[model samples]
Target chain A: MSLPTHTPVWRIKNSPEDSVVLDSSDEATFALTEEPVPSLEDGEMLVENVFISNDPAQRGWIQKGVLPERLYTAPVREGDIMATHSIARVLALKDSTDQRFKVNDFVYCMTAGWRRYAVIKTDPSACLPVMVPQNVSPTAALGLFGVPGFTAYYGLHDVLKFKEGQSLIVSAAAGAVGNVVVQYAKKVLKAKKVIAIVGSEEKCQWIKGLGADVALNYKSPTFAQDLVNATSDFVDAYFDSVSGVILDQVIPRIKQYGRIAACGAISGYNKDVGKPTMGATWIEVVTNRLTIQGFVILDFMFPKDGSNRVATEAFPSIAGALERGEITLDGTEDIVEVPFVDVPKVWGRLFTGANTGKLVTKLA
Target chain B: MSLPTHTPVWRIKNSPEDSVVLDSSDEATFALTEEPVPSLEDGEMLVENVFISNDPAQRGWIQKGVLPERLYTAPVREGDIMATHSIARVLALKDSTDQRFKVNDFVYCMTAGWRRYAVIKTDPSACLPVMVPQNVSPTAALGLFGVPGFTAYYGLHDVLKFKEGQSLIVSAAAGAVGNVVVQYAKKVLKAKKVIAIVGSEEKCQWIKGLGADVALNYKSPTFAQDLVNATSDFVDAYFDSVSGVILDQVIPRIKQYGRIAACGAISGYNKDVGKPTMGATWIEVVTNRLTIQGFVILDFMFPKDGSNRVATEAFPSIAGALERGEITLDGTEDIVEVPFVDVPKVWGRLFTGANTGKLVTKLA
Candidate 1:
């Protein structure tokens, strides 16, 4: 197979403002341009990017300066391909040295840039050969069988060690990670009560369809009272992705020995980096004996030995569930697929709550 | 052995204000009075209290009305004997039904009231027979080999699971639990560095003598900077007995996957029960991925099955250390032994930081 002669890529200019969409004057935040495809070296393969995963973490990565040592990520400089997880198809293999992947094979690359085509090392450590199971779409790989799915799996199973019949509250329940967390907590973990906090009535319905026992819109004026009423017996575990006010409200309601899986703080992502995000109080933590753990899925996926349990266990489990129709992406009507040029616009949908389920941009 | 005909007891009259001694106007916070000793009933024993343990948690228990459900202890109601740990000698046994304890035996009781003599249930579940090692003072049973020692043991070993070569920071390093935590972290766990935070220069010296690698007065103007300088690599585990600004400052300096053993929040104990204490931010907790656990030692000492690992393991370990001269309390000059009648006055010493070591009152 011949590789494309020219590939279009989105490059970061300036960071996005605290808004739903990049301002017109901040067009420099991201620019789309076409360039000649670079030649692949030995043990390299050329890939046609199919879908780019949009996540709240992207906001932290694109910021201009060095973040705190704790929140540190490789800075996404100007004119560089914005970093993301992407599903791609191997268009050409430069050498026959690597036998794990070949031409026409679909693969998932953690280092996939926001580009139409990428040159990825054929090293299995760099990318994995993705076998799209029957009846599961490639998009589902980015949602239910992807990073978000694995994050929820390891967080609830390993971090929180969520027990059967325990009550759980998930923040950002309609988003990529939260949706999967709600489903897994109820369907897989057998959680007694699954309360979901979302931003809109539509998201409440969306999360409810995903097997959430109770879904409350945080935007509702009765959000605080609704949370108290829903979790009268107190939650045994909390999966927090939006960690500002939601965390503050949930902290007091957590039962003694409750576990909190701190996945993301999207509510504070748009704020100035290093400025403290609100909601965590030591008083509640000490009084209630709560255990809070923050995690990044890559730590498990790319461990010191380079063996990824997510690929071996979480992905397979999610795939098997999908094949059996125990889990489905049927009601994900808001998974908007925008063209490659509109990557910036689609990425902004995450902050504005304009899109739901998994937001993926098609590059092919 | 004949029990005392009359016993002097301190009972709570009203709560205290901010002072080193209970205000005369609030003498109702506690009243010392002589009363006829109650005769022991079947399955009961009369004990002549030798030493009454004073702790900062007393402040929370003696608070006026119903505290928030989180900080609720059975309130030390007006005219009730203030509850505390005590070392007592069995003066008389009413019946021979329970064989675990007998007359003249020295035992430690969690239900020991603030009285010169107490009528205790001979039920093995309510009290444990204490074997005071030769050359080890009976008071040491309430300090180095008691609740504080066990708290430090389980917190670091089981809760935090602190390993050798890891760094640790301890708050309230001069208090009963903090003192034991510092010594155990250094002498037993072989931690790489042990940073102790206290309130005074005397406490700084006191904890240093207890094997802290570095000791800093949290009251010092440069305390925060001193903590950062002392723990350049960040702390792996924190044995926090004082949670307030110190907690706020130390949370950010915690390394990834750090553990915090929340033993007590003495700094917040004197404050209004329900009001939130400052210094713990969720950003660092989520960013650093820390685990914070609040613990009360009784939960471990008297677990649901009544089989205590503390009684079997920690007590023996501390006794062995004392017998081997590996641990000593000879230089604890700050252990002020106030008269039993002055219990109310001395109890306020914990909040004011005017006394140190194990503040005990002689009731014999």
Candidate 2:
């Protein structure tokens, strides 16, 4: 097999913080160039990027002064190759003695970057190229079975201490992690009530179909009153993904001793993301004895013993539920395909709400 | 023993919210009047106030808008009798069948009013007159063995999930709850390092004497720089008593996965109390994966079965430590004796830092 010497890649040209707000659509902010692909060391494999995930967090990654670094992942430096999570196909192995991975095995890569081909280390170590389960679609490695899903799992179960029959609420419910959280609370936990907040009516409808008892369009003119009418005065738990205005609205309505899993601050990711945006005040937190926890999935993703936290703990249970048809994901509608070369502009669509679905660059 | 027919009492006249900030010193805000004492009912006891506890939270309970009602206790309504936690001597018992109390028994009262004499209830029900231990001075029932110490115990052990050997920081370290928190962290928990934030050098010295490894005067000109130098980049836990400027300063210096016990908002009590103060941004929370909880000692103080969470759980453990000399409290210096008629002015001193001590009304 012949190995490719040059790879097409994108790097951060201008930082997101340099802009008034994060504008991923500004092509000048991203640089597309060709770079020599370095030879892989032992335990590393050369993989072709099959599907690269374009996440809302990407806006924060290539930015500064918005969300601080080390929230979920370290922010991509000003001139660093843009970071990505992707499904990849192994093309060649670096070590002849390494039998853990065979050529053409589909794997999930954490540092895939915005490249057509990359070198990633595989199993027997806790690097990248985590083998994708063959039983599910490989694309799920970048979506439902990946970081987004794992985030939902931990936020709902571990962070929120969610219990069965409790009423739960989620913001950004149609987004990658939010949808999974809604499904898990409604279907798996059998929550008495699950309310979801989304930007558009279509997104609201989509989440409601995923078993949300009530879906509120946050962009609606009557969103605040709508939330009040929909909620039974207060909810037992709140899974907050958007932490600006919606957070403020949800704060007063959370029941006393309510648990809030602050999974993401997507709404403010383009702005100064993590300052206690308007509504997440200490008053509500104290008055109600609320427990607000901010967590990053990656913090729990890798264990020092070379075992993957998600692979070892989350994937088994969630995948089993998927196979049993107790919880379903909208595979056909929630994913958008973009050409590998249109990376920057297509990635920008995430913040613009141009498409309310997971954006992925398809290379192979 | 006979109960007094008329009791000299104080009632909220103007309400703290009537001013720009909580002005507990405004004499016009309180009205001292003589009221006919109500006859005792079944399971009730007539008690004479011995020592009334004046807490920083008193500024919160008598105000509106600054803090929402139901923070630690109900906000004192205008024209309502002033509330105080006190040490009282039982004069009479209405329930002849009740063997829990006897004349001259010293007890802790949760809802003792700012009056010379009042009617409370004792055991077999969750009314006031919680029996005080015989081993400690009855005065300790309103100070070290009372609500302030209990607040510190729960905030340290439960809310912050504080562990021995961890670095801990506390604000208002010489005040009612803060002093106990500092002592618990340093003397009881054996923390690696304990830093205290107080307003005055006098308080700084007092808290240092109590066992703080370092005490920073938040009122100092170089307070901010001093904090950065004293903290080894970050601390493991912060017991935040004053949640305005001091809280903002401490947030960035807390270590990864640090816990914050939001005990009180004394600094902002006179301001817009519970909104996101300047420093507690979600950025710090998310990046650190922080668990910030706001709690009231009262919530746990009462059980549906009528047992006190504090008396049952916290007192036995802490009082035993005190008796064993594992920890010591300042008896002479930290308690300020206030006259009964000076309730409004004395309570205001709590906010002004006029006296860095637990203010108590010695009615007897």
Candidate 3:
């Protein structure tokens, strides 16, 4: 099928240093442009994005600096479209015999960059463009069953080997991934106590309702003491999102043989050489025999072994729980769903702690 | 049983700031003294040291500042007897009915300090003074089956969860623990390739005999490039003993899902605040989804759960392996067995790289 002549998109247009943390207002940093859409080929389908995800890792995918072949997902080069894991619709399927996809089917498009409409492959070997399972909103599909939620799932279940009745404390607890981790730890994993650290008091209250035993604002004067007080019995596991002072604060508070799933260092991503202010303390790690595991969601989703546990494990667990009404995305109540034009601006809000939970944008 | 009125001993005489990295020459840092021996109580035994183990962690046990009531062994404080894990002869047992220890038995005495003779407990609740398994020399028992060897056992088996046929790399390959790790990985774990990094060509040659596929002298000018070339398939596990610039060099060379057994930071032990030259790089840790675990030998020896895997698992395995003569301690060939008086001098050699393999002093 013939595609549209042109489609609007965003491409990085700055030096590698400034490529981190997108700011749409700065045209030099990120340029909004139009590119002619190429006609679809066999085994390919045209997908129109309905909702797109914004993650803190984009700050590390500095244009021109990110590796060309990162096993699963390659970072976009300068002048190329910025990538996002999005919920898109199969607007047009090029192959009549394609068993993987159908026209008008809602799909989880893995490589759906910033463009409004793009061609995505639906071959057997392709990792994304899977049908978004039945009866879930685009928000739930992208936010709950997407990268953010799956990251929480694997980081807890696999990395931490989280056990029931074990206490868990998470930093950036109001974020998309962090919120899901907090809820999953308390509701599904049956954590004895869940300590959620957020940036503001408002976010604090919001996360507390999502099964957090104690929601402490990291900005408070007594935050450190509050964390200490809350951890009467040192935590069994920690889910780290902001890795500067917050991670340093949590490290010493963990008990012996405790686990830390280092997911994101959002606070350090835009720094010089992408280094956090304080290096993760090694003393506590050694003295307490802590296990610090760092992970990216894509690894589990499209694993080299072809396990695809994200497809087989996380998606089913989250969807089943949602279906059984076991757990709700209560923390997503204040989600900042922006329009396609405001993707750049809302992304900036992530750094400023302006957004509450999963911050996505409506593309169509 | 009657014991000697006094026993010659060594004690920490310096301030806590100067406690790291032992320097016996500095009389102010470590001083020879004598402690009065008391009559043995019930379940107590008088033991005379045969061989005493010297470790880099003694530097961090600086006199006066170590925390008391640590879960396992407590660090020596200023003016107290400096402790050592020694093979001590059970000179006198207070209880003839004691099942854990008997007089004349060469026991693995956990709390035997740097002294000619001392008293240790043998109760069921007591953690140490374990009867050394028969059929091994003092060096073979302490260096090959003691803390150092068992450290390699659990670090690879538990922390790294290492598997056969996967590649492995280790630093300080000629040291007491590292030598065992190199041999065990190739001879026991059946690793496809084993890379052993050491300080000198002489030590490198020695480790090669211990089943290392490739032994690289880290001090060579082309060490970095040499390491890169050696990791053709990228290593699956890294057992770290020296955590300075060497650890930074090894992190990026690891494959995805690499496991790091953070055993020792000997290079940083005497540094300011016990910090290494370089904080472990976090970028590669996160990108590659690595798991870095730190552990202390005592934790496994006398675990909170009372599993005592060190006794139940490591000792038996090492003893059985020795019985079968499957592997040998070739790296401990250049042993420096100093007298009790020369300990102060040899202990300082650990930092200058003047000594090889295990550094122990004969004390009777």
TM-score of chain A of 1: 0.90
Q: Among all windows of ten consecutive residues in candidate 1 chain B, which has the lowest summed lDDT?
A: B272-281
Candidate 1 per-residue lDDT, tens place, B7-52, comes to 8887776655422235555445677778888877898888877777
Each model's fnat?
A: 0.40, 0.50, 0.42
Q: Model 2 lDDT vs. the true structure?
A: 0.73
Q: For candidate 3, what is the lDDT?
A: 0.74
Question: If you assessed candidate 2 against the hidden native complex, which CAPRI class would it receive?
Answer: acceptable
Better of 1 and 2 by lDDT: 1
What is the C-alpha lDDT profile of model 1 across A105-184, one tens digit per residue?
Answer: 77888676888888878776568766567766777677777778888888899888998999999988888888888888
Please report the candidate that would top DockQ against the real structure. 2
Interface RMSD of each: 5.2, 4.2, 4.1
What does candidate 3's lDDT look like per residue over B1-364, in tens digits?
Answer: 6657888888777755533434555646678876788788887888888777777766656534544422235677777777666778888877556676777877776677777888777754332444445744755666777778889898889888888999999998888888888877888888999999998998888888888999999889999999989996789999997765687789877888789998876665555423322222455677777888989877776687878787788878876766666567544734566667666666767766666777776652
Ranking by lDDT: 1, 3, 2
